[model samples]
Target: MARSARPVVHYMATRPDGTVPPTCNHLARYYSGLGETIPTVNLADHIGETVDHPSPGEKWYTDKPFSYFHMYTRPGEILERLEVEERWPVRLWEVEPLGETGNWGNDFAPYWLMSHQIRVVREVEAWRAFGHRGMQVLATLAQLPDLARQWTEEWTADPEGTRRTYTAWEKRVDHTRALTGWAFCRAQYSRREAGLQAANELAGNAAAQAATAAGADPHAVALIQLRARCLVAGQLMFDRIRTGEYEQSIRGLLLGAGLETPAPALA
Candidate 1:
């Protein structure tokens, strides 16, 4: 009959200078649970974003979310086919698998568009590509501006008669956005924790069974899984932080609201 369509992927980038980021190809690929399918690219390898194939003329410096997609087919199948054809057993597991054109290269794309800043498109197709869950699952992150507005209206409704108080609408609004963004990051990492745990269990099958059979702190495995997830998720968050796209907007909104958005805790 018909085959399932592989979910579109959203990859995040990691920069050489070393900065905290909220999104990146690495994060997108890992987060998308599809595993060993989607590809990733470093910021250095990226020439720039293109809209018209050859990139038009100047090759706008804008960063666009990217990933390969067939008209109507699952991406996972394509990847599986490649793995067998290329016979890339051990190498396939590497974060960056190679095989373009002849061997079938891992397609890469941006998760979001950025010209002067980050653009939010809820309808974008690849939302679920990177794992089944991400910051996108968080409800408030959908619209930072509106969320900020609503938060401000309720937070300081009865501030001192002086309009110069810290409770100004601008401050409240900015605070909400920052808080929302932070919350999103927190949830995004949780998914990684789950993924890492699964991977480790698969790796240490014997340890898992022994632990399971002995009944020696069944909860011990939970912490191990969480630590691994956090480590990887932390890196993903830091990569997005480097982009400064989401963070910049929050800061700008906070500035307008007279609130200070605390720096992202990338560490």
Candidate 2:
């Protein structure tokens, strides 16, 4: 059977003249080279399309908003311009400079988050909506009140085997894979610290009052507490999708998962 075609996305960057920039042209060429089709349409011609009555192109872009960055100018440049114009009074450089290299503050965090956990979450939601088992693990997490008990049984039955399984699972949900130093900006870090504290408190409460009541192993109970922390961190991340504080949510998740620091800053 033939594979289903991926959706096509259309976008262009406008220069001061309202004409396509070299960057936009470069993207069209790159996508064409890869056997992808990106249609060109003028905003003037597409004015008839509104949020309520979107064209096919608009709908596609809405579903895949990252398409804008995939073929657009550097985010640092965009934000810098906004700062210069005083239209975007938010000075990101005050928190961290937009380094030129493969740096943290540039655009890496957003791309990483989109390509990793955020993408996984959306895929899981889509699968669940369609009544598919592709996202069964997450669904199981939602339904299982005493994940600690379940994990304890598995671990007691197969010590090495359970360690390997949970370790691998932990890596897949590793928040550091999608976060960066941007998440540790002073104010954002404070919020992340608070989220982590809440998770710890919840886990401790569960362990103290409900561990034996639920008949869960101590180690497994710890893991379940970590998972609860992960949930809080994930929610925080989803809340700041388009803000400077975005990375902190991922950071919080990492901390909740017992990670010491962000994953070595991507070398």
Candidate 2 Cα errors over 4 Å, as ranges: 1-145, 153-159, 170-196, 207-216, 241-267
lDDT on C-alpha atoms for all candidate structures? 0.29, 0.34
Write down the TM-score of every candidate. Answer: 0.20, 0.29
Q: What's the residue-level lDDT of 67 in candidate 1?
A: 31
Candidate 1 local lDDT, 1-267, one digit each (tens): 899988543222222221112222444445566544333232333223221122111223213223321111221111221212121111111012122211122343212222211111112222222233333322212333243333234323522322233334334443554433542354334333222222223323333343334343434333222222222333223334334676645433322323333223234
lDDT of 2 by residue, 183-221 (tens): 223214233332223333444454334444565566656
Give the lowest summed-lDDT range of ten residues in model 1.
Answer: 87-96
Where does model 1 exceed 4 Å of error? 1-124, 135-139, 160-267
Name the weakest run of 10 consecutive residues (lDDT summed) in model 2: 115-124
| lDDT (C-alpha) at residue 3 in model 1 | 100
